[model samples]
Target: MKEKFLCWQTSGWGLSLLLVLPIVAIFYTAAGESDEVFSHLMGTVMATYTSNTFWLVVTTLVLALLFGLPAAWVMAMCRLPGEKVLQWALVLPLAMPGYIIGYIYTDWFDYAGPIQIFLRDFFGWHSVHDYWFPDIRSLGGASMVLALVLYPYIYLLARAAFLEQSTSLLQSARLLRCTPWESFRRVSLPLARPSIAVGLSLVAMETLGDFGTVSYFAVNTLTTAVYDTWLGYSNLNAAAKISAIMLVAIFLLISAERFSRRKQKLFQQELAHGDDVRYTLSGARKWLALIWCWGLVACAFLFPLMQLGYYAWHYFAESWTPEFRAYSFNSLQVSLTAAVLAVVLALIVNFYRRLDGRRMTLVPIRISSLGYAVPGTVLAIGVMIPLTQADHLLNDLAKSLELSPPGLVFSGTMVAIIFAFVVRFSAVAIGSIESSLAKVSPSLDMAAKTMGYASTRMLRRVHLPLIRRGCLIAGLLVFIESMKELNAALLLRPFNFETLATYVFNFASDEQLELAALPAILLVLVGLVPLVMVNRSLEKKH
Candidate 1:
């Protein structure tokens, strides 16, 4: 029994370390000296990069809160017309990537695009000098584009917090003759603060990590700096340093969020029962709430989807070519591979935790799960640094053996990208599997043990079957995320290799988004599967 326990513990630690290896590689590489490139960046572009990234995170957080808080409040606590449809519809935007939305909106709002053309013809304006317009490729525009998609994170978590709040607290406030708005402001908002902070932290990390959206808008954020430093100037050391800087920022945000959550727990109120009294809107208030909810859904999900469908319909033949097939195949191949690997890794760590139930065993799960908070750009930089060195070592070894040098085996192949994907998304799988495994009764484990089953056989016979649904959900979530991922994919894709994300990014970068509309739409459609599943799960829980 002791030997088996030792084996399981070692396996869990090994797997957890493997998942975190890329992140370790990044910081290790960054610790090395890079005086020349670092000095040049500091003197030239670092300030602008830091400033833009700061404003982007701040602006996106504010906008997402503005859009999400009221919407979440209305949907969770108020009875408005079409509330059911609006509730799920609001979540649809979470399925769309920020970069895809940025590209689509830029095309629509550009000076020569349909909106401007119609305005010009209608108002008899001839050219740019005849009217004033906001540039779609600016920092402010990028923030709004990201907010439109990312607000769903805030909505989901904030709404869940609202729903989980004690009804008696709100009723007591009402009994004190407080207005509905006042009750929410004084009661609901405080309780939901930690959840909102978590959502905002996620938005901030995602914005900081964003490459395609910021790149499309010509915003010189740190993520773009990392890419340009590595690929444009061929300076891996500089890129790693920039990535490390971003990682520090992300860690600070995560720590702040965790602290906020701890405070929330300290002050949290327990509900006596699962009962919530929802307010019903009437007169002008009703219509206002209806418009607010539906308008968000329209702007976030429906509008872009309609545009993609229109473009795909007209350009299907041109867009759906052999290259498109290759891109689709590559996306599925990588996404499925990453999904399976992540699920397996998650199962290993979680199973070990189940068997041990020790504080030390839980540490590996926490450390491994931290990859989700690390930006994809940082993860890619981390992955590439070590793999590149390993490839160089292998080539040198082959040369010493007097054999034809095997070139670029790890870094130049799909291995690095897939490894990055697994590291970045293993958290999603771990969360899902852990939650599911927690629901399994300990009695089942005891029963298996009484029947003389070993730990491995017990897991295979009991936990595996019980958590199959969770495993599927985990796989689907990781699969969808892998499909929409852009930063890591953009940075790590080999020469002439393109996933659907990179394909759409390339076309959108060249202002040829119409040519890539089919793939973009397909990506959105694929993303819907997990969103629907999540909605169903949430509904079941509610």
Candidate 2:
């Protein structure tokens, strides 16, 4: 009875409040506004935004699968040396913000950049029309930049699913003389389908939520359209309308993910076993495997870090200022707070769901995590609309109650910003914590209870002690995510607030890459620590 009550209070109300608040707020704001805004949006940017957003999503998804699957396959199936290191190294790119990659790639591939410049000098071509070259700021360039940074989500999840396959299953295939590639296609891909779906879902969400890269490349996706409506047209009503459209799109995606995973099951093994059965790769194939792994790391991690380093070296002597200190503090505070809070909320929700022993938890937990799916600008609008309404409602309540209203909860405060982070990132934390919880045998809980320990004690003394590393991983994932978060912070931050990401964004928006370089570098550096820790934790578990 007590356990059920706890579940109701935490997952029931707390999570329920979070789940419904922004949604309700959005509807209410739409209702309060006139229908004239919708007509205006439909006439202008709506069709263009919808088309661009759809194409970008499709392009990014296709590229991510193409680039991510082979690498995941190579690292997981082959017995190549450094394969262990490659598994962890694949996650390094998660530390780099998508926009930062945009900034670097734009410069690196521009006509005046080294690549095109070298081509020109080599061929003795002088004028712009002398040679044909693709523009890095095009829709195609946006897709490539996004795929490079985002494929890690696919790689990590797919690799885990690949590794988790039973050796017995593969051995049976080998008895029939099936090639490893054939076996992977027949056995591995089907079994690994769930993880691939999950990874693809994440990629889709990140692609949608992206603002910096799309906006930097002048790709008029839905996110950038929202900005134009709000800032350029000075029409908040039209912005809210478009944002609501985006919210519905995200909700549909959440529904689709739910439908896909509904019938899927995770096969639980009865015992622990080490993966000592290894196959050898030789000669040309061996070199190919090593090259594949190194090449991915180069594209994902080394390239971006080197670019940031070069920019920092060229610009640091001029860009450093006392303003950097204030921005640094803001970034650290927001990232740490958001990461901690999101992880804590996720722990409570996961525990309640576990105690109840219902697969239904998957629904709320997944939906709560859908903040990742909604564009950050759209999410900010969703969050801000509700917060502003809540503030207005509180002001009315204050007059009626003759007391102060709880205006500080969200309006132009850290509370609103942090709440945005929780909604956006709780999914990542839940993924980590749920994975840790899955590893802990249920018999341990039963054994602890039989020893006269209650549920609280079991969690504190047993589960927490065992899953400390997972909690660290979950927290660190949240931290890195928050460090690069831009759209939400840009829209929801209080007047005069500046985090490292937002500070860099302001400079980058002015086409001042030299000025943005320091904060961007710092953002990547801070993000790397948590990312490295996540990779290390996963490796230790393996």
Candidate 3:
């Protein structure tokens, strides 16, 4: 038993350390000097990068809350028409990448596009300075684009929090002659504040991590700066230093969020799963709520999706080239590989914790999960630092042995891309499997042990059967996340390699998003699978 515990416990810690190695390498590499590149960047574009990143995170969070909070409240509090469909439809935006939306909107709203042309002709305006129109390629536009997709994070959490609130507290507020709005403001919103904070943290982190939308819109943020600093300057150390800055910012953001909830002791009971607990809206109120919910769905998901469909239909022959086929296959191969590896790692560390519930056992799971919180671009740079070093060391060792150095094996191949994906998304798998495992009865473990079953045998026979559904869901979730991953893929892809994300991003960057519509549609359609599955699981849970 002691030997068995030693094996699994060390295995768990080893997996955690593998995930953490890149992050630690970032700090170590940042500690090294880099030919005054850091100084030049500090004197030049650093302030602009920092300011843009700050405002982008702040504005995007506010906008996400603006869109998400009201929808969450209405969904939880009211009986609306087609409530079931609307609830899931509102989350469809999570399937659409911000860059795709940015591309479609920028084209539609540009001067040469239909909307602007109609405005100009209808108002009898001439060419230059005839009227003012909102630009879809600015910082504000990037924030809106990001907020559209990311608001679902806030919406999901806030609605779950509201649903789980104590009915007694809300009733007391109503008994004291509080209006529905007043009861929500005084009793419900306060209880859901922590959940909102968590959601906001996720939104802000994603906004900070974003590369494609902001880059396409010509807004220079830290994520863009990191990309330019490395590729343009060819300075890995400087990029690592910048990534270290991003890690610091992430740490502060996470710490502040946790600190805010340190004293919060709120607990909630589940909301009943029927219409009796809901208030039915009528007349203009009903119409307004319906408009609020459905309007978001149309603008965020339906509109962009329609635009992509239109483009794909019109340009199907041009868009579906041999390269498109290769990129699609590449995306599938890489994402599926990452998903499987991530699930295996999650199972290893999570089951270790299941066996031993010590504080030390928990450390491996937590440490492994830290990779998800690191911004994708930052994680990419961190991944490069150690892997590049390993590649060089291997080459030198090969040369010393009078053998040909196998070139660019780790850092310059699919290994890096898939490794980064696994690290970035392992947390999603861990959370899903850990939650499923927590629901399994401990008595079953004891029962199996008394029946002369070893840990591995019991896990395979009992827990695996039970959590297989969770594992499938977890793997699918990771696969979709890997498919949608843009920032890291852009940074870490092998030479002459392009996933669907990077391929479409390149097309959008080169002013040819029309030609990119087919792959863009593929990205959106792939992402929708997990969202629907997750929504179904949530429904079943309730």
Candidate 4:
């Protein structure tokens, strides 16, 4: 028994160490002194990068809260017309990538775009001096684009927290003659703080990880700096250093979120009725609420979707080429491959924890899952460092053997891209599988063991059958994330390789968003599958 346990523990630890190698490589490479590049960056553009990153995080968080909180609270606590439809519709924007949003809105709102052109024509003011028009490429504009997509994170968590709260507390507040607003402020808001913090932390991490959106907007963030340093200037050391800096910021944000939740405790009434006391809006208030929720849906999802649809229809003949088919195939192939591997690895780690339930097993799972929190850009940098070294070693070996050197066979290939995707998205699989596994009764494991079945056999015959849904969910979630991923794909893809994300990003970077519309819209549609599944699951639970 002890030997079998040790073997399981070893497997878990081994996988964890493998997953964590990229992060370790990052810190190791970043420790080297690169005074020339580091000093130059610090003197020239480092401050701008750092400040833009900070303010973008701040601005996006604030806007997401402003947009998501009220909507969540209204849906959870109030009775409004079309509430059911609006509830799920609001989450649709989550399917839109921040970069795609940036691309679409920038084209629509740019100085030479249709909106400004129409305004100029109507007012007979063609010159720049005639009026003040906000640049969609500014930092503020970038934040709004990010916020529109990211607010769903806050809404999902905050709404769940609100719905789960016991009605007794609200009743007590009402007994004290408290109004709905006062009750929410005094009781509900405080209880939901931890959940909101979690959502905010996720939003902050995503904002930090963003590359394409900020890049298209000409915003100099740490992620972009990391990319430019490594690829543009051919400075791996400096890029690693910038990636390390971003990693530190992410760690801080995660720590703050965990700290906020440390003392959170919720008490539920054991036999409480299913009835929830909700406030009803009427007259102008009803219209205002309806407009507020619908407007968010329209702006975030419907409008952009319509724009994409129009462009895709108009450009279909030109855009639907063999190359586009290749891009789609590459995306599906890589995403499916990554999703399967991630789920299998997650099952291994999680199964080990189920058998042993030891700190050794748990710690490894936790550490391995940390890659999800690391930005894709940082992960790509970390992954490239090790792969590049391996390539050099391979070339050296080939030279000694009097053979042709394989130049960049590993680093300049799809292997590194898939590895980065697995590292970044394994957590999604782990979390989903973990949740499903937690629901399975321990008696099933015990029963299988009593029948002389080993742990491996038990998992194969017992847990596997029960957790099929979880495995599917995990794969789907990971696939969607991998499909939409831009930063790592942009950094690590082989020469002449083009996934759907990279394809759209390339065209958008060149200010040719119309040419990229079909793929971008397809990406959005693909992303919606998981979102819809999640919404249905949430509805069933509520």
**What does the lDDT read for residue 406 in candidate 2?**
60
**lDDT (Cα atoms) of all candidates against the true structure:** 0.89, 0.79, 0.91, 0.91
TM-score of 4: 0.97
* Candidate ordering by lDDT (highest first): 3, 4, 1, 2
Give the higher-TM-score candidate: 1 or 2: 1
lDDT string, candidate 4, 411-529, tens digits: 99888998999999999999999999999999998899899998888889999999999999999999999999999999999999999999999888897777899999999999999
Candidate 3 accuracy as TM-score: 0.97
Question: Which pairs, if any, clash in model 3?
Answer: none
lDDT of 2 by residue, 1-542 (tens): 55534644465446846855675666667666566656876888679889988889889989988878878877777788877677778788878888888888887898778999899999999988898999999899999989989998888888877777877777778898889788889977988888888888888878887899999999988888777766677666667777877778777776787798898887744113555544588999999878877887898779878877777889887678888888888877888998998888777777766667767655666666656666678877778777777888878888799987666566668878887877777888988998899899989978997898866677899999888989998898888878788998887788788888888888877878878888888887877787676577567656
TM-score of each: 0.96, 0.85, 0.97, 0.97
Point out where model 4 deviates above 4 Å.
Answer: 269-273
Once fitted onto the true fold, the runs of candidate 3 whose alpha carbons sit more than 4 angstroms away are 273-275
Any runs in candidate 1 off by more than 4 Å, and if so which?
A: 266-276
lDDT tens readout by residue for model 1, 289-359: 88888999999899999988999999988998999999999999999999999999999899999998878
For model 1, where is the 10-residue window of minimal lDDT? 264-273
- lDDT head-to-head 2 vs 4, winner: 4
Which run of 10 residues does model 4 get worst, by summed lDDT?
A: 267-276
Candidate 1: residue pairs that collide: none
